[model samples]
Target: MISDKEKPEGTPKILPLCYKVAEHENIIWVCDGAANVGQIGHQIGVLLTNMDKARMCCTTAVAAGSKPHLDIAARSKKNIVIDGCGNRCASKVLENAAVKIGYSIDISKYLQKVPTLDIYQADVKRIAEIVVKEAHL
Candidate 1:
């Protein structure tokens, strides 16, 4: 183990392991796409996770037919899907895998979809709060 001096000043934040905590945690799967709305969706997931409201899992792992991830999605207390646009790629991935979606939102509906990945913290906070209310997290 490292010495105390090697550690950071603040307490380390240890989020629940998605796979291990699936039965008790709300699992978030976001479409980390290439646009502003997509980027915001990703940030929303991070915000919720950091707030201990949910655990963000890898959407790609489920899409790639990873048994562990698929099981996590199915076993989660709530599977919250966040898609950046109308395409709903993230939702479709879970649907295709037969995982039930507890709640889902299309970020494009709330924010204009832009080409750039840069997003505003205000937007992220707004959307994340909406998610907390809607998903009952």
Candidate 2:
């Protein structure tokens, strides 16, 4: 039997692209807009500290049928998807097109009990720390 802490043999601990992008120090990070309302956005920033730029997709454009373009965008470079909830709209959009997801961070499931933090500069920094720690980045 496998231990809880053990990952399947050959499975990468971090996203493959994350490792690849980290090598260049210029990868793009993408976040779902659902997470833009509060500390989640800030947390994303923290998680993105290792990247060249981080952008938020605040609309359903990709989910609304622009999946090809989104896939194209994701393919243009290493991509990490951060979804605020488990609905995983962002991951789904990319996965459906057979695109590989470098990393996926779900905030709703991470801080299940913490009260919503107001979307502020400080809050963003705080949340970003949580995300970075969780991702071990």
Tell me each candidate's TM-score.
0.91, 0.49
Global lDDT of each model? 0.90, 0.49
16-77 in candidate 2: lDDT tens per residue? 34333443332333443434432464355444542424333322455565754554445444
Best by lDDT: 1
Best by TM-score: 1
Candidate 1 regions with alpha-carbon error over 4 angstroms: 1-12
Structure candidate 2, residue pairs in collision? 42-124, 43-127, 43-128
lDDT of 2 at 78: 45
Task: In candidate 1, list every pair of residues with a backbone clash.
Answer: none
Q: What does the lDDT come to for candidate 2?
A: 0.49
lDDT for 52 in candidate 2 is: 26
